[model samples]
Target: MQFVQQIPGLLLLVTLLCCDSIRAQDSSNMANMTSMMANATNMTANATSPTNVTNATMVESPMPAQMPMNMTQPQQQQPSIWTTEELVTDLSLPGAPNATLDVRYNDSLQVTLGNKLTPLQASTAPTVCLRNVSVGCEPPFALLMVDPDATSRQNPQFRSWLHWIVVNVNSTEKLHEGDQAVPYNGPAPPKGSGPHRYVFLLYCQRGRRLQGSELAPEKRKNFNLAEFVNKTELGPPLAGNFFFAENP
Candidate 1:
């Protein structure tokens, strides 16, 4: 009888122990679920936020930082060659040159504004080219070569010594074909004098072609290009080039 009573007590204690273990496990499982739910809620909030979304979408690129707002820089403005050479102030022209004038004396000697050349190098006549000629409406052209700094830049009493001139060129390539107003004279800057600027000017002949007379040597001294252009109604020069020459 005693043994049977003991067995019932022992069974009750065992049942209590089993119930406690199951309750602890259930509490642990509930804690884990709560943590998982908090993590999922944080992820949803981040996904919905605009700032977070933008940060995730943006891709860092090297080119964008280097380039301007527009894909290219604003034409990267360069200083006009005409203005740099002070052609406007020196010649008293209305504005900058309208077109390019290719002035090549020889295969070895090509000329641009402000280019330096020896007096002996620029001896021959240059082949002038106005390649930007309009179609059908080809106008006659004129070229005037002058030395603005005749004696010296400071003492320009013999200013604008006309070295060469041509008038009424129908074709762009046929500069030699035109009437030679003055023959080509090579630059002869006196020794000890500074560099002299020799300007090659091209004018678009409009209205009527020039029937010019033989120019005397005395008249070549102090030649006024502006006055002649106005007299002949040749209009402003379309293009021009210049080079600096100094005696050896």
Candidate 2:
């Protein structure tokens, strides 16, 4: 009929130009999704600002300095002084009938005896002497004579006799017959004179006592083996003195 009524008005003008190009591509994809959600809400408000959180805790970085802790060391030294002069020479004479007496002493005869000589006995033996040398008191004692009945004298010149004399003995106290004054005497040696040599002498004191005269005519002389034999000019009597003997 007139080209079939102009083909239904050119198929209703190509279906209204494909519904206005699908509403202009859905309004250009909803304006590019609202400009990418406004650039992700302005980069999440510049990372929670506060000047980027105080420049991340003021440019952080600092901590270092600590060294010196160690110390302990010191101790050593001891010895000032100690001596009993060999326990006072082993407590003055300890054994051996004082073995061949020579009781050594240096600072000029510093004797030390009395460990226990029965304490200078008298009725039983001690009383040897030569104290103040003699005086009105009759103190010129001299008796040390080891007897065994004076060695069975048949006139061995009446054998040993010296018996009890004693004289001033305090020399720093040591003669002990347990001292009530002095009393213990044992070894009466002259029976055969085989063992007799007792000597106990200890004296030291630079000065003192020597008045003489106790029957003084040079003190009734008698003990002479050539002028009172020498043992280093035996002296010291004014204050400190000691003597004891037992010869056979």
lDDT of each: 0.78, 0.34
Models 1 onward score TM values of 0.65, 0.19
Candidate 1 wrongly placed segments (more than 4 Å): 1-78, 132-137, 214-217
Question: How large is the C-alpha RMSD of every model relative to the true structure?
Answer: 7.5, 22.1
Please write out the lDDT profile of model 2 over residues 21-68, one tens digit for every residue.
999999999999999999889878877888877686665567666555
lDDT, residue 128, candidate 1? 82
lDDT of 1 at 141: 76
For residues 1-248, what per-residue lDDT tens digits would candidate 1 score against the true structure? 99997998999999999999999999999999999999999999999899888788777666644544557546877768777766676667777776766788785578877889888788888788767554233558787888888788888888778888888777776554588878888899988779898988777777467774643345778887777778777777777788999875
